[model samples]
Target: MTRDANRPLRICMISYRSNPHCGGQGVYVRNLARALTDLGHHVEVVAGPPDPLLDSAAKLTMLDCLDLYNAENPFRTPTVRELKNPINLLEWLSISTMGYPEPETFGYRAYSHLKNRVHEFDIIHDNQSLSYGLWALSRLVPTVATIHHPITRDRQIAVRSVRSFWKKVKHLRWYSFIGMQKRVVRRLPKFITVSEFSKTDIHAEFDVPAERFHVVPNGINTELFYPLPHIEREPNRLIVTNSADQPLKGLYYLLQAVHAISKQREIRLTVIGTPKEGGGIEKLVKKLDLGHIIDFTGRVSNEEFREHYAKASIAVVPSVYEGFGLPVGEAMASGIPVISTTGGALPEVAGDAAMMVPPENPEALAEAICELLDNPEKAKELGEAGYKRVQEQFTWKNAAEQTVAAYREAIRDHRKI
Candidate 1:
């Protein structure tokens, strides 16, 4: 069959610093773009430095920016050549002053590139890069942003988690970009969030009305997370994919629970991530004396992720609050029983298939882990149920279709205005 050039809608997805390793935002972008293309739409991603990986069918336009926070050499001072450009200087100055400038700078860079080719795209989809540049683009084109969750939630968690005034101040500085995001969210005609919890949080935190928001839960990449049943599961092992460096992830609580569980029974924990050297989590593991039984695999490839799931008896997501718990969906898809807290959108994603406990409760977590460990039959039932639920409800194809609906709605709303 011959391809029809005019059949597919041209899309421009803007993301300001998508690090695939750091979090789900990058995963969301990569998987969503590929799924959208699979639906016959032409997606062209305009991403900032450290670009997102996309499907071969989708084109990626790497928008150059000062990648000061590049994980390899985070907080590195800009070179003399980098300072010659005003935008680069602005980015460097902001970072030097303990501020985040990527969203604003990336938005400016996107606008600079898109202004000349604005007509080429059917609509612009901003991936939470709330900057003045994106606001400018909204004026000229139909624009909608996907704010996964309000950043204010993260900041609130961080501030409350720490006692040190200086550390709180540092947390505030790193997340100072919320100012830009909130301002931009207030002005944008339409934006989407991944869950009802996030929609309510964004409205309360940013004072954006519920009317401007759309709820589209993220999808799990089933292909990467499905079961490898040939690999034997460990009988007394627990696995959790944690944001090891952040308190909001509740890794400390999980660690405490694991310590308690280990004392009663010889159980091991496999953490599918590495904690930063000298970070709070690393210190806590030592403090709790959990080094021997706990294993932090740092970052792992997709094959490794599935392999880890295959070897684990159960999966846990101990986040205090999640915009949407990708780990829960991924674990479910991997045919692993999940034990998650009733935090944020975890319940929304986990539904009734997995065991639930309260957030920030080590006692509740240990009870759940122990109960499942003691009953192999119950664990297997939960695992099969979780896998069935994910197969029926969550997949990238579904997310892309729902997202496209929002995009078209945004376009229609823009023309009406």
Candidate 2:
């Protein structure tokens, strides 16, 4: 088909926080916007807090909200000098006492600026902010939202894992924003989710009709995550990546499994994220007496991360819940066999290419690891299959094409109203 002579579509992608070091949403916004720009669309990412690592082709509009959630000092108190402004004080107090993540509050600030200049874009694509501001935007412009998955699942799993009833209460309080999210999602005209698993789960959890949801799988940056042909994998070496000390990640089970595996086999586990000096995960490592065999790499650059993936014999994703499992796909893209639990969409992401285990089951995880280690040929076959699967199904180009089509659909739907 020939290109349309009309000017390219202008798209504004919004995310409250897009720090690449922290989580998946940053990577989603960064890559999707770049891919859309490559497809001859004008893309601008309006974000709060840490900046997104965006391509030069895509413009970035930073909406500063004090960035209290940066990983370096996630909840550090602002100085009195910094909080002389009443609004800053309110933001700090609201987040500290109420436990609501600051993104929604920040989104309101971003939306205020964006609404005055809304004419610059043909569509507004929100990366799961689900704030009241987003609801307002739907009233003014062609708007669509990507609800990665229901946050309610995370709260449920986290609460279940906590032994203390008070801790569970705290978890519930922290995730109180879920009520707001469900309300916003139920009323939204169009919603985008990364996988069919997430699509169904969101519909069931948020009580939204399935027809209103659009399935758009996330893409992988194959160039950065490709296999290292020259690096030979060391035996009994494993890798897992997650934000440090997050209970929902199910790293505790993986740690237990690694300890069990080490009792029989000489094994080493490399955690791609840092653990606090005396945090729960670190304490667990010490208590289990497996500190000698486990290592935390803190934060590494993209190149170093790929090298870590290359050197590992296997990649384990033991998350209890994931809206989409990027590490599983990235490891697969790196031609490493994955041992992932059937947490949320992990089975959907891994499919038949990688081994699957039930979540929070160290015995099952250990058994799968032993099977892979004992049969190197099987592991190698799985790795190759995974690489092929990722190449065939997950790529930025595919995601971009589908996203553009979704944008068009959203625009057409908006026109009808």
Candidate 3:
């Protein structure tokens, strides 16, 4: 199977669910696949949809599933005809019982798809679908997985966020897939993650050997996030990308900060995401009576992102934890002065270009926001600095080169085994 080092490597990048608009997973898949292809590698993305929206250079293979979590009709019971396939039946039954089964089911689907064609690629790069089927795939090909961060942290935070016993039980049941991830990841020979913090934490939680992990920071998509000079920056206007109800995103604290600041001055906060109807965040905004000052821009397109940044005086990331903090990098790339909390790997992404606050502290977020608003010169300077940092250090080209090194290492190790 040895090939010339100068030749392009055939890479199959797999993801169970990939929607670029949803979360970091889709974003990661899209950017990484494009970058790798740009590096003269033959790249293909094997994904379960809502489309990944990949660049035309990279090939895309759509893997179908029941898609029970589709937003239009979430958790809908699948038709009996759809469940005729054993895999589809397993997926429906698992979700019906309050268990998340996408990762495991997708792994099975991927294995079934690729088992007969193992020689089509030099390596299989899994985007955290750490499932039993992945282990089986590893035996057939050189497989490496990227564990963005341990979902164990998610489970811990979710369990702690709820008060009722049954509610907590439901959360535990939903996150039961994490147990499968833990079992599968440890068996893989090589792993990739975004930050040292993530690598350390995942090793501690998943008990994977530290040497097995490779740390590669995510790249900013500058094409979508660069500053718009033609657009005027509005004063006392702030923006944040919100996962409104998730305790992990810390939008609740940001709402409080906005409420406190509004008492003394004219301030407006534009959230680049929608809150769930009558969700905790929506309720919090109503309770604080901050609707006048806060505007949630539901479902922003990629083209509209920079304009939102251009109009904002400052951007804030109030995350309780992050594996890499893509929003911080996006803000930095957009040349917006940023105030970010010292959450997991946020400081790593932000470096010294942002104002750092203690996570989950509304008062600190308020103070930092106010500081930037009161001093336009300082805010502008920080924005320029952040833009410079991203340009010099966070290009997808750099990430792609590092990732190829890890891929080669995995290939060599696989051959030896």
Q: Per-residue lDDT tens digits of candidate 1, residues 114-187?
A: 99888998889998888999999899999989998888888999999999999899989989988888888888
**Candidate 3, after superposition: displacement of residue 121 in Å?**
0.6
The order of the candidates by TM-score, greatest first, is: 3, 1, 2
The candidate maximizing lDDT is 3
| Cα-based lDDT at residue 338, candidate 1 | 93
> Which residue pairs show backbone clashes in model 2?
none
Q: What TM-score, computed on C-alpha atoms, does each candidate reach?
A: 0.96, 0.95, 0.97
Candidate 3 — which pairs collide?
none
RMSD of each: 2.4, 2.0, 1.5
Kindly report which residue stretches of model 1 are placed more than 4 angstroms away from their true locations once superposed. Answer: 1-7
What is candidate 3's TM-score against the reference? 0.97
lDDT of all predictions: 0.88, 0.86, 0.91
Candidate with top TM-score is: 3
252 Cα displacement, candidate 2 (Å): 0.4
- Per-candidate clashes come to 1, 0, 0
Better of 2 and 3 by lDDT: 3
Evaluated at residue 357, the lDDT of candidate 3 is 100
Q: Which lDDT tens digits does candidate 2 get at residues 1-417?
A: 335424578999899877777578988998888889888899988888787878649999887565677667877889888688555676788678757756567667767878888898899999988988888888888998998888888888878877998988888888987877888887789888999999989989999999887798999989779998899888899999874677788899998998888888799988997887787898999899987998789889889998999899999999988899888999999999999999889988899999999998999999999999999999999999999999999998999888887888888899899
